[model samples]
Target: MNELIPKETPSLPSLPETVLPALDRLVSALGIPRTVLASSEEIEYAWRDLPRELREIPAELRGELIARMCVAVSTGLFDGAMNYIWNAAVLHLRNKIRTFGLPVVAQIRQSDFEEKHLLELQDSKLLELCLKLNIVDEDGFFFLDQCRDVRNNFSAAHPTLGKVNDREFTTFLNRCVRYALADSSSPRGVDISSFISAVKGPRFNHNQSGIWVQRLNETHDAQRQMLITMAHGIYCDPNTPEQARLNSIDICNGLTNSFTASIRSELINNHTELVAKGHQDKHAASLQFFERLGLLGLLNESEQHHIFSRAVERLWTVHNGMNNFYNEPAFAERLLEVSLQGAIPETVHEEYVQTVACCRVGNGYGISNAAVKYYDQMIQNFSPREIATLIRSATNNNNPLGRRVLSGGSYRFHFRQVLNLIDPASVPNAVNGSYIQLMR
Candidate 1:
């Protein structure tokens, strides 16, 4: 079992008083006019300033004018405002926001290219102003430390994808959006811009816009990682990550029938009765069994997280299913004639039978009587002793996997025999019963 521990916290940074004003000036000087109508003290005093000429204005009118002022600044309406007035107002607001202890500049263009696109200029004059101010650098815009990488650095690039390698899932999202527009013969660029604007509101500054995009990209990258991990876990090994396991559940379910066949071929060889009667309908019966076993909650969670935590539980299910094949009296004597080496553990037959009966074999999609019979015959005909020795060696170990493999192998051997016999009518009833119930 693994133990978790808490990490030590790091020291907090000492915030400087001048940082806010400097950041505010940096952004505002880049052609975005800052309008500071009132100082923090003035605004606080405005509440008491009510009853004066400013108070004579209706509250609704005052609100409208303030909103209008914001819109005008955002849309670059008061372009003729004196440079000194704009700079002074910006400085005041910077100090006001800083006094409250918030980051002055959340985002900023780090490179020349980023700055050019981050804040789309409304006119050539705005671009000229930005250039004159030297706001745009040589590369992209630099954001605050809150930003995280969204791209997949580990995955190899798709051969046909050109330069799309390492990009985050948002890159795919963008592609999908473009595809959808093209398919519908719709106006794309404008519609996409509008959609983005609706999602993140109109971009007040390039810095804010960059931050928003980066945040979204980070989220998509996380989801993509989960998906990739889940797919690998279910198909390759049970010990995979929880997120990956959960993602692979549907794939596992789809492959259940084939897995069921493999289980049957490995478990109840040469049993015609077991074949005829069939094992319980796995999907329905196994689900009900788990519910009765007080394991339904875990089962559901496994369905959600890919059941890696219940490695023991899954082994039990497999064991139980295999034990059903062994109880068949027809197969009991037939084992003597077959090569029993690798087929089943001669020394611990009783324990093997018990363990197999307890394993949880889910919906019949994974175990088949025909397959079990074939394995039984193969073990008898070619390597029964090897199979038996395998069982014995597995049993001697402390690894829970030892028990799991012994149980699964025993079933596989019998399953091979059952299939070889191919006479469903002669199948064993003992092999059809769950060993779990028998033990109980």
Candidate 2:
């Protein structure tokens, strides 16, 4: 039957009488079936597609493997040709990786990436390494990985499941060339060692910081996140130099707004762990680190309370010290800014209300003229509950805030002006008598 399986080799596409004469004689003597090879039609089809595909490869890449592949194609051995072409593509990929700097790969991976390790990597793993280092972009990785699968299932490199047609072979070869065999001139991985050194070394002026920021902009997300988290760690380290902290903050402020949710969660975890471990100095610096980035809202209420209470205590201490008038304005302004980040939490309610009252009523000498405006602004923003506390405390004899107002004439007048800042309706009914008395 002409349509029978294997189709009696002569019925398949014919090969030239002169071609493979010696091999044909040897196979005939050994009783080997010609059907074991691809048909002449398949070989012809492969040749038609081969030249166009091979030309796309860099001329330098088409050396021994390309030559062997041509031999295999002429002999109608598509499997062996697939093997040779894949080998060429893989060899090119490896060479490209070497050019991309293994030291930088080690840094991005956060592990050592020596030459031997690269050499010993299996094909799939080599592709994975390229993906992580961004040697192959997402679309490139997707297609190259498919080509690897085709090579494994249909190539001579392994026990192939079955044969592939010429069109399938060309498609596989095309993908390998397009994705893994491209020029390696573009990707430059971020070097972790020099990155850490630059961040910890000198302070960054505009152009200096801009250069490093540009470098980070070109890297992929994984390395971007790692570097940002590293910068946050450096900033929060209690033992870091002030200038290093400044540099780290500069780097983080540039990157934080673009942070993925994962990065934000990681930063929150680091800050919370410091608090849980009672690393007081790190916790304090971490607070400022969050504050400087305008991320105070990312912190929990308890952390916000601590920041508020501590800021108030510092301002109160400096307000009573010898250089009170000269030193108080900056601290007062910072406290006002921190308050605007979130609502005052209940944990620091008393101190928050009374501290502003104390600074407003002044000491035995006089109020800080430079600090008074910030205090007046804070007074105007106090909630009804805080207003109630402020009014009730002025009548309590044991309260330092009350004692200050009761001590002198100018104190009483400044306290009255502070009370006038509140809308009458915002004052609670229970504290109405105390409020009226204070305003008078």
Candidate 3:
């Protein structure tokens, strides 16, 4: 038979003979299960923090063992040898649980808790740590400032806690009802600001479905007729203030498809002339208006710009050659700059015009004139052949100006001529002497 050797698994270290009994006593008091208690190796790892014995193990091994000890302590398991360290770990985990969801703590109330409630609990991790360590009593409420406050209290007999005893258990539940209603912490609360106003009555006439009408006709309505008054203010028979117009837009943005189409159509019918008038930054404004009108997919970038540009042109014509009315050069330049921030392909003259006018990319040489002088300065230090290759590459990369220069063929001839002067031996094999001749 072939020789067989048994493989041994890594064994936990033995607890020190003198400390073993005391360690066992601590574990018993903490109510930690024997299986969950830190192993002897974990205890040795914790002891590595002692100065004299620190050098006995590799730093990586020390970190690994410490992490294992921490995991045990976080779950309330302590192996007596590292009681202080275990206490600190529990405190840290408690703090962590407050700002983050804790599997153990979250499981305590399954029915009442939600993802958002869990997130709120997670945010109070440090508070949880305080509760775990008994550093702060649950009844203590800490006022952060005028805007906010933190209340930590252990309520054992909360309505949600039915049947669960009012035992002297420590709990820190931050009572932030006002802030919670106002805060937009969760994705579901993206429109929290408006949502809060709606609940507070007449302030936000949120529901479009005659709910406001039904409330107004109530026999025993509130002390004041605010809802009816606000309704009258909104539909003042003829004139709605621009501020109200903007508020309606804000409300439309806040809503999630409830009467959105109706509201948008009403706004358009009332605001068509103003929108078509085209204000400053008409491209951006018009684009938003078109989106509201559900006409966004009907246009492309160039088409949108073209429409705005034409409208501006017409507005200018209507006011005569004054140019002060609309389509001002400065305005067009700003719109063009915004439209062409990154750049697509354009012709040579167009690119140069854009570059010089500060609309497109600028040459690194700081020369502004899109003429032969700048090109000459660019090739001053470089070989003509190298310049030709550089220009050729730029052209191939869709630089319209480069294509224009190369199309002339004179620049290439000049480049080859310059290469001849730099390396005479290579010039003899030249397919064409145009570049070399120009350099010479």
Candidate 4:
């Protein structure tokens, strides 16, 4: 248990020394026995004994609940203490449900229960629903229900047909503090931005990283998802430092399977949205994510193939008819990266070759620098037939536009590199000798 009480008590205005005297007068006026009044020392002890987790409760409730518990214990008003315990439990449960979001809360409502009817739930039913949602475990639910029974039987809110002893009341109060106030449904101390910063920072050593991974494992699903989503953003940002990106990837790989699944879904969704919006620069992030997935060996063969194929198709869509391929360099580089990672399937090799071969130069200045980088990768991966098809497509007479784009100016360097890869005899007769000489 965390320390709820400070080691030393300062003079508190809410718990004044005069409070007992006023209570004594009230008890006297009611003709109650004076034996019920307890000493100041006992009140202080009760306050000191409160659990640390309870200190994190909302300030309004924490102050009232602590004061009331202290007064009840000091005055031997066990029945009243039980009532306070019940109130604290109810407040914590309600707050937890609200934090869970309305979608989950709606699942708890009765079919006919309207939004205004939220507060109509009885305490017992609320505990039951929380238990159903796994918000509270079975033992917690049982213990809270038992506390409710005690409150109903002896607390001041009821007729007090029975009485509870100080020991029983204290036990109930401690249980409420543990099960309700300390529930995991509450927001964790760590937030998404801070989590991202920590992961991307170089300060966290191996032991610290292990500790964070354990925390992620224990974190609630909603909060874990938020952390992953933020981490993905950092990982995808092109401006993110290289070391930070690598660190982020390491952290993400350490996440639980559930977290990984959420990341996968989020990436797919982002890709779909970017495609729909026709945002070219944003698509680079998705391609980067795919390359990372390949490099990390996180993706299975089928998933890798699917992602690569979709990426190629998207590239095809973007560059299909446009003369200037704004993303051609990035597209070609990502293809080579993915291919080098061994993620691209042999089945897609033909399509991959054709896509690069058919891609048009945006302008004289916008040569396919990525395609130049991709030359060695293509040589290593492409079959002879595929290589021949690529050369023919770039140099064939029927496709004068393709021939002009490949054989002209700076593009000749890439064309010569391609020629060097295949049999010299396989080269088309129409190839310019000047460009071929430049290859030497």
Candidate 5:
């Protein structure tokens, strides 16, 4: 019976005399129950995990935020902690945006925020703008969204019917520290600025160049874009020294290689999603992505081969009965112009030739013409055996598509000439006579 007596909960440590008025005012203004204020023990427990940099947050708002968070956690007022985190995160993001210069701030406000009402945006809108500006990546944006949801649904600011828990509040608080406050350093932006200055000034020595390349390789996708854009600016500047321009070009090429590799990986990994979206959408997306790279002059011969090979594979495998091979013609033409002749893998080349042989008018608007043009451009690079194989493949059964491709078109004379050079014996006497007549 004695052991059955209930024990009283321990009281929280008292607030300092100086801070008591502020805490009382905050509770009154926020309209939260005084019981939400935490014990000193609870505040100490939560403080252990607080980021060091968070303590450096400016004195004005930081004190209020820290006090509220401690109270909220100690008193099981998770919603109050969430609200405080949201305010602090928004303030941090706004400060970061202002540091990016007026041009960037104006651009984000115009594009992502309302022009006249930009200042009126709340936390969620601010986070959305940060996301669009690449100030925050997707995962960071997601956590911020969760914080917003919890604040809106469970905090004292709203009329909540349910309560949040300690785990939820702590998770949101850690994310705020990690994604919002921690990002204030801007080291990546500084590195990009330094690299641009180096590239614009003079040619880098071997060691310097090696260091620059390594840094560029390690950057995140957003930073990679900034580096590529800066390189392009240097490459296009007429006053740039030849050595500097050449170095910029090399950097752009390497970055482009990284870009294309990631794009290829994505295509491979998301093939099912792309297929469900239909080939037209997938083709358009791929072409636009590669074309942007090409315009930057980052699409190298090897990358062209890679993209063309993938395009050919999709052409063969995916069956869109509408017969619209969207963007194939443009891609093939670009591949022809950029790809190093004779560098295509044997398997890819074989598939490409076969694809062209089976071509019809609607499969892609100008695909047949593009394929024929590529073959003509690359004919000289073909090995004698490859040329012979192509001639045999085209002429066997008088392949109508092949015949159409080779007979009296833009590449007709060139195809005939290559045929005569590689394997004259394979060219029938009638075909040779017609070629001679066409030449006349």
Candidate 6:
């Protein structure tokens, strides 16, 4: 019978001798039940796992609340320990936001943000603000939010929704420490208000602009994407001041090398939204935004056509002006560059093909030699639709570019070269007859 008796459950580890006794004396003197706190056995279980979390945090973060948490854990008051952890975490996040700057938060949130508001933010709102500021990343937000819920429900901050076991409390501690406490040092937020002022002010020269670009590089990826899109929106706003528009695009151009697919998708969505709402001025501005950023490939075919057609019209008008050769290359080259960004939209295939041929073939006098390569490169990539447009245009002798092809000499000779540049495979069966006529 004695041999069949159960053995005792071994103790894990212990805290200071006086820690739980002092708490017991205080609670007993206050006539409180000892059972209100967890058992020493439970405390031992929870405390064994605590050191790993405590060790991972820096010495500087082990402040008053952290010390209080240690005492709370030693006294078997897991609720109080978590409450202390949560308080410490909240203060750390607020300090981070303060260091990031209130004005910048005001700018991003589009509301009056001050120290008073920061102090007054409720816990849930505080978490959301941290998420928005990029002070807390997405995964951190998830875990921290769970911690906050646990702190409210199971910790001593409020009446218990349900009791948390030693294991549950330690798990909460790990999450709070790892996600919020341990990860606090990285991902500094940008002061977007001052940043916006700098961008909208006079202008940023290369050195001046490079400084802002460097500041962006120092921040988190999400915030960097946010600022990039913000710059795009400012550039696309119809009422934005001219210098500001120039400054906005200039800043974006610097960050162009680092653009991700996410950033491209965001810009495209904004452009598409404006177009859908028939916000013509902003929509047109957005197309120019993508064009200037060399991101036309992100735009849909319709938007690209809109961009190309406008570009072609502007250049064609310039090409027909006085000193056409000297005055035309810059605008003509811009048009050619825009076409190269993506496939020429079929909607403007006729005008697009004719404009390039006209610029390449020149008028009665001479061509802009600076623009010849741009025109030639654009001609060489003509799709079957575009090749057909160029050929079909030649059949209409009364049209401006068609008239140039029929006038013979260098004009007709240049047209023949343009036809030679087109891939015969690209010529559709429908336009093969016209293609043969032009080639001959």
**For this target, which candidate reaches the highest TM-score against the unseen true structure?**
6
Q: Which residue pairs collide, candidate 6?
A: none
The clash count of every prediction, one per candidate, is: 98, 0, 19, 2, 1, 0
Give the deviation of candidate 2 from the true structure as CA RMSD: 10.8
RMSD of each: 24.7, 10.8, 20.3, 14.8, 16.7, 9.1
Off by over 4 Å in 4: 1-48, 51-56, 63-66, 95-116, 130-168, 182-300, 309-367, 370-440
Q: Is candidate 3 or candidate 4 better by TM-score?
A: 4
Q: Name the weakest run of 10 consecutive residues (lDDT summed) in model 4.
A: 6-15
What would the per-residue lDDT of candidate 2 be over residues 1-440, giving only the tens digit for each residue?
Answer: 56743211112234456655655665688898866767667777887677777766666666898889877887778899889988988888788777767898886677788999889999999989888876788888888888889889989989989998888888888888788764535455578889899988988898888788877776767677788888888988878888899988887777766878888888899999998999988888898999888788899988888788889899878887888988989989998888877778789888888988898878878888988889999999999999999988888878988887777588888888888889999999999988877776
Q: In candidate 1, what are the lDDT values of residues 359-424, reduced to their tens digit?
A: 212123344343344334433343333333333433444544244434555544433333343343
Off by over 4 Å in 5: 1-64, 105-119, 182-184, 187-220, 223-440
Tell me the whole-model lDDT of each prediction, alpha carbons only. Answer: 0.30, 0.82, 0.34, 0.61, 0.56, 0.82
TM-score of each: 0.17, 0.62, 0.26, 0.42, 0.41, 0.71
Clashing pairs for predicted structure model 2, backbone only: none
Pairwise TM-score winner, candidates 3 and 6: 6
Question: What lDDT would candidate 6 get against the real structure?
Answer: 0.82
**Position 317, candidate 4: lDDT:** 64
Better of 2 and 3 by lDDT: 2
Give a tens-digit lDDT track for model 6, residues 1-440. Answer: 45753323334356888876877898799999877778777887888877777865666787899889887888788888989999998998898888777787787788999999999999889999888877887888998998988888888999988777789888888887776777547555678777888988987788988888888887767789998888988888888999999988888888888988888888888878897899999987888888988888888777777788889998889888888778887887798778767777778888888888998888878778888888888888888777777877888887889888888899988888778787888889998987887777
lDDT string, candidate 4, 1-440, tens digits: 87776433333334566777877788789999866654445555555554443454445456587678655766667677777767877877876666654443453342443335447778898898677555677899988888888788878888977665545666778778677865435532243445666867775567777777666665565456666666666766677776776666666667734555656666667666766787665556655665665542454465567657866776666565464345566666666666666634666665676665545332345555555455456554655556555655565546633555456774555455555666655444545353255346
Q: Which structure among the candidates has the greatest lDDT? A: 6
